[model samples]
Target: MVYENGKAWEKIVKWFGYKLHLIVDATYELPIMYSLTKASESDIKEGHRMLERMEEKQAEILKRAETMVANRGYDDTKLIIKCWDKYRIKPVNDIRNLWRDGEKTRLLTNYKNVAYNYKGNVYCYCPETGT
Candidate 1:
């Protein structure tokens, strides 16, 4: 039994097994890479491992990749930076709301009337109305 903590909703899940992590091409619906890890492993960790392995075993695929889309489970800053800085691939992972004190939607810059939410959705507020 694993007690998942530090989440908005916590629960004790009765699970004991391995998990299959797959890097799939969304357009073609094909599998690019795969690995099996213990259930306790984190999605971010597995994502990093898969990218590292791809660099060594399948550099061509990584070079041709444009974006890495993933679920909220893999919403990690280090992993996102790794994909962009090393491989130049834009990460489109769903983000978790990690803001404190119930904050939401921060201004992108003081000069611009643009703001973005935790999920990376940009909003352009009207300067006159400030909506």
Candidate 2:
């Protein structure tokens, strides 16, 4: 689990009606990993701190794996993120209606510059037309 600003707090309020956060580290497959849970305290209030915690866990796991595979000179590891959503949450009707109207414009404007450059390159490379 990862916490983003007040998102976790909001989730706690919405779900369990609490306002706390927790950071948990555990060993899985002989390596350490971490997760976040919201409660009544603020364990991670900033994104950067949460990122640091993640990096710390990753480094610990890497060091442990390296030590275990010292003789082989190589090791393989995989990290996974698992999320559990209990409530069937949906956007409000008004928001959904407004989103349907504005989504295309938002998406188009967001990608317009990138798409223009790509299309320019495509047309520049036309073999028959010799653009």
Candidate 3:
């Protein structure tokens, strides 16, 4: 697995372990599915793979899911697009903050007050967008 899976994230952490990823039904609060992978894995890829598994193993529940929420770690454009395109499930993954010279900053500085909302409706809030 090391040759195909492990990746050197940095110098100190010689990671050769696995990570557990899971998804749950928001309403029922029951676990839906889980996956284990090498620690050097990408969360976005794992997320999609988990959904694909759900499509095969739990098609009924997967079909009914309207929205999916995840942290910034799972933030990927392709994942977001695929969630809607393949399953009609909206992805509400938190976006990482943009940076300026290694300093964290909002993506759109002009709209300082414009907040990004992922609670249910996945979109940014602005007067023009009718938020």
| Error at 11, model 3, angstroms | 7.6
TM-score of each: 0.66, 0.21, 0.65
Candidate 3 lDDT over residue span 1-131, tens digit each: 23446654544656799988979887888888988899998888898888888999999998999999999988888888988998899988778754435632233556644443333333365666655
How much is the lDDT of residue 94 in candidate 3? 78
lDDT of 1 by residue, 10-129 (tens): 466675999899999889999999999888889999999999999999999999999998989899999999999999999988888788868688887675799888777889999999
Candidate 3 ranges beyond 4 A from true positions: 1-13, 98-100, 103-131
Question: Which consecutive 10 residues in model 1 have the weakest lDDT in total?
Answer: 1-10
Q: For candidate 1, what is the lDDT?
A: 0.89
Clashes of 3: 0
Best by lDDT: 1
Predicted candidate 2 versus true structure: per-residue lDDT over 1-131, tens digit per residue: 44665444333334454432222332344334333555543432322343356556564533333111111111111111101121111111111122334333221344332222211221123445534
- Candidate 2, 122: how far from true, in Å? 13
Which candidate do you rate higher for TM-score, 1 or 2? 1
lDDT of 1 at 5: 67
Off by over 4 Å in 2: 1-14, 17-32, 39-47, 60-101, 106-131
